[model samples]
Target: MKAMVYRGPYKVRVEEKDMPAIEHPNDAIVKVQRAAICGSDLHLYHGMMPGTRVGMTFGHEFIGVVEQVGPSVQNLKPGDRVMVPFNVYCGSCYFCARGLYSNCHNVNPNATAVGGIYGYSHTCGGYDGGQAEFVRVPFADVGPSIIPDGIDDDDALLMTDALATGYFGAQLGDIVEGDTVAVFGAGPVGLFAAKSAWLMGAGRVIVIDHLEYRLEKARSFAHAETVNFAEHDDVVVHMKKTTDYLGADVAIDAVGAEADGNFLQHVTGAKLKLQGGSPVALNWAIDSVRKGGTISVMGAYGPIFSAVKFGDAVNKGLTLRMNQCPVKRQWPRLFEHIRNGYLKPSDIITHRIPLEHIAEGYHIFSAKLDNCIKPVIVPNAG
Candidate 1:
């Protein structure tokens, strides 16, 4: 097997590795067909997240065929094509029973918060991820579902993380009909959230980003207004002005650790590792939104303290909702939306690289070169 192993910051290579085998009674080994490099993976690539050990594979958005399943895995068989959610959890746990699969208590002994996430880091559970020819899925019955008849593999791959998380972010917004929704960041999650806001009856959807290419995607794919924060003197004031001075009814933060617009924050958080993650995006969400509006954060941040505007959020009476996104929970509506031609999740996929070229893919995506939006890894490609 060949897997993308993390050597150090900005260093990764596809190296020959031992094939995974079923390690638990409820485990299953999947032969990966399609996998995606998520925005969150950049955190590990840049060495921002703690406990990301060298030699660990970093990928969570993946879909594949089951190679083998343990005796206890009754929901799936060896030949089933499955779209595994990023979460690795036991379905019967207290959190899982409440549809909070991302916070399952039975997995990730290191976490008192988020549950097991494949390939994230030791902090989220040190399980190797699917950025390879194969991966081992624990609690297989609870996490993966068979790819539906009409769904494309690329679409299935995005559903595992980006699409699901973005949809969950919109759901958290609790958007009333005709409300104004402003999304921070124009990455996959932000794009999807902007698109989903329309489905949730938002009268106006605005996507904020520094990149014109992504803002263009927001206009075409999301049918929303675009805000290039780099062109503004103060993005918060610009957002307020754009929303008629009262501010947007809802604001969602989709840019996690490596947000731009603030050099000091980025240097301190993403570069110097002084804080968990740069709080620039979240602060923008707080400052740009209306006083009583909702702020939904779908961005991936470390499990450590961040320099956020908690006092301002309290003062404004904002409803801030966020989570790792119970991916499976969002699948039902998302599937319906995809089937009805309301969304083509793979529309955002700008690059597809072979497993061996994952390092180059990482470089292209990390550098934001070549208009790269999303990149998929084909592990079994010829």
Candidate 2:
């Protein structure tokens, strides 16, 4: 099997690796058909994630065909086409019982805060991801769901992470019918969050980003207003003025870890690795929302210190709710949205690359070249 193996920072290449086999009774071996390189994958690519070791695969958003399944995997079988959520968990765990699948206590011996994630790193659980011809899926009965007959594979793939997280962000916002929603970052999650806000009855939606292409996508794909923070002297002020000076009713930080804006924060957090992740976007979210409003954070950050405006959030009585999304929890409603043509997750896809060319795919996405918004990997490209 050929897999994308992490070398060092800023380095990755396709290499032949041994095919994975079922290792647990609830395990399944999936032949990856479609997989995506998520925005959060860049954090691991750039060495922003702790314990992202060399030779480890790095992909989480994938839909595949089951090649084999263990005896205990009753819900899935050979030849089933499935979309596996990023979270790997046991169905009966305490956290899983409460539908907190992302924080399942039975997986990831190395951490207590998060459940096992496919190919994220040792920090979550050292489970290999599906960026290859085949991947090993644990707890297969609980996490992998068959892709419904009418759903597109690409749509199912995005549902594994980006779209689901975005919907979760909007749900956390608790948006009132006429509330104005401000979303920071025009990445996939941000774009989806902006789009989902409208579904939740938001009166207005604004997407913030430094890139013109992404903001353009937000306008067309998400049907939201756009703001380029690079053009504004202060984005927080711009958000406030746009919302009639009281600030937006809700603000969401979808850009995590590698946010740019403050020179020192990016340097210390992203470059020097001194802080967990740059809090520029998050701080901007805190400052951009109205008092007593809600702020939803779906961005990925390291498990360390960040210079967020904790005191200010308290002063303003803001409700901050965030977690690694419980993806399967959002599936039922998301499926209905997709089926009704209210949302098309595949609309955000900009590039599709063969597994052999994934290193180039990562480079183009990281450099923001070719108007790249979302890139998918074809493991068995013809």
In terms of lDDT, which candidate is strongest?
A: 2
For model 1, the stretches where C-alpha displacement exceeds 4 angstroms are 261-264, 303-306
Q: Which lDDT tens digits does candidate 1 get at residues 147-226?
A: 99999898999999999999999999999999999999999999999999999999999999998999999999999999
CA shift of 203, model 2, Å: 0.1
Q: Which residue pairs in model 2 clash with each other?
A: none
- What ranges in model 2 sit over 4 Å off? 261-263, 304-306
Query: Could you tell me every candidate's TM-score relative to the true structure?
Result: 0.98, 0.98
RMSD in angstroms, all models?
1.2, 1.1
In order, candidate lDDTs are 0.92, 0.92
